[model samples]
Target: MTGEDILYPPRASAFSWRIFKTGEIHTVSVGRRKFSADFQLVFRLIKGLIFLTFISILVTMIALPHMTIQDIVVCILAFMPTGWGMLQIAQALKPLVRRAGFWGSVKTLARGYEIVMGLLLFTPVAFLAWFPFVSEFQTRMLFNQAFSRGLQISRILGGQRKGRSSRNKE
Candidate 1:
C-alpha cells in the first residue's frame, strides 16, 4: 500500500442500497413446505430506477427548458428531483432506524436533513420551488446562469474537491 492509502482508508459507507437489496431473504415453512421470496431485489431495482428518473428530470429541468420547450414541462420536471430526493432520504433512514434504534436514527436523519436543506438553500433549486415556469427567454437565460453559479458555489461550500482525500479531518 502507498503512504496516502495507509493514511487514508475509504470512508465507511453511511448507507447502502445494495444491502437493502439482496441483503435479507424472507421464507416461510409450513409442514415440510418451504416458500421463499426475493423482495430486496425488487425493492432495490425500484429505488435505483427512482434515482435514475430523478437525475433525468433534474437534467431536463435545467437544460431542456431553454430549448423552446413548454413551460408546463419545465415546471413539472422541476419538482421530480426533490420528490425523488425525499424518497431516497427515507430509504436511507431505514437502515439507520433499524441499526441505531429510535433516538440514534432520529439524530442520523436530522443530520441528513441538514445536508439536504443546505443544498436546497444554496442552489437555484430553491427558487424553482416557488416559481418553476420559464416565462421569458431572458428570464430563462438568467436562471441558467444563476443555476450554474449556484451549483459551483454549492460545491465549494458543501462538496469535496476531486483527487483529494475524503478522510481529511475537518
Candidate 2:
C-alpha cells in the first residue's frame, strides 16, 4: 500500500459510465463507481439483439395500419418493463423520502405513480385519438423493447416521463 493510493481510488467497475446530456441522475452508473474494466459482454450483446428486435417492431407498427395479434401482445409485454422500472425506482426512493421526513412513502409512490403512468400513457392516448395509428404490432413492439430493456437509473432520478406528454396534432 502506498500513501498515494489513499487519495486516488482505483476504478472498480467493469463498465464505463455514459453521462446523460440532460444531466439526469446518471442511471448508467447508479451514481457509484463509474468506470470498470470488467463487463458482461454477453449480456450486453443479448440486450442489443433484443433491442434491435424491438425497434423493428416499432417501425413496422407505424408503417402498417393493421397489426397482427402477436404485435399487440408484444407491445403490452414491452410496456411491462416500463411499469416495472418505475415501480422499482419509486420503491427504492421510499426509504430516502421517509428518512428525509419529507412525506410518507405511500404518498411519494402515489405521486410518482400519477406522473409516471401519465407520461407512459401519452403515446397510446395520442395514437388512439390523433395522428396515423401505428399498427398494433409496432406499438406493442415499441413497448416490448422498452419494458424488456428496463428504464435507465438516470430516468428514475431525473423524474423523467414524470407525466404524460402532449403529442403534436397532425
TM-score of each: 0.23, 0.21
Best candidate according to TM-score: 1
lDDT of 1: 0.46
lDDT per residue for candidate 1 within 1-170, as digits (tens), equals 87644543332111222122112111111111222254656555655665676567546644643323454354435434543564466567777645643433334444655786688677765565466463464476767876766657666656555425566643
- Tell me the tens digit of each residue's lDDT in model 2 across 1-170: 76544532222100111111111222222222232334556445544655675567456654553445664565455544544565566568877755864334334445555776788789677766565455565677777766666755557756644443323332
RMSD to the true structure for each prediction, in A, is: 24.3, 25.1
The lDDT leader among the candidates is: 2
Candidate 2 stretches with Cα past 4 Å from truth are: 1-39, 66-170
Weakest 10 consecutive residues, lDDT, candidate 1? 23-32
**What's model 2's lDDT at 12?**
12
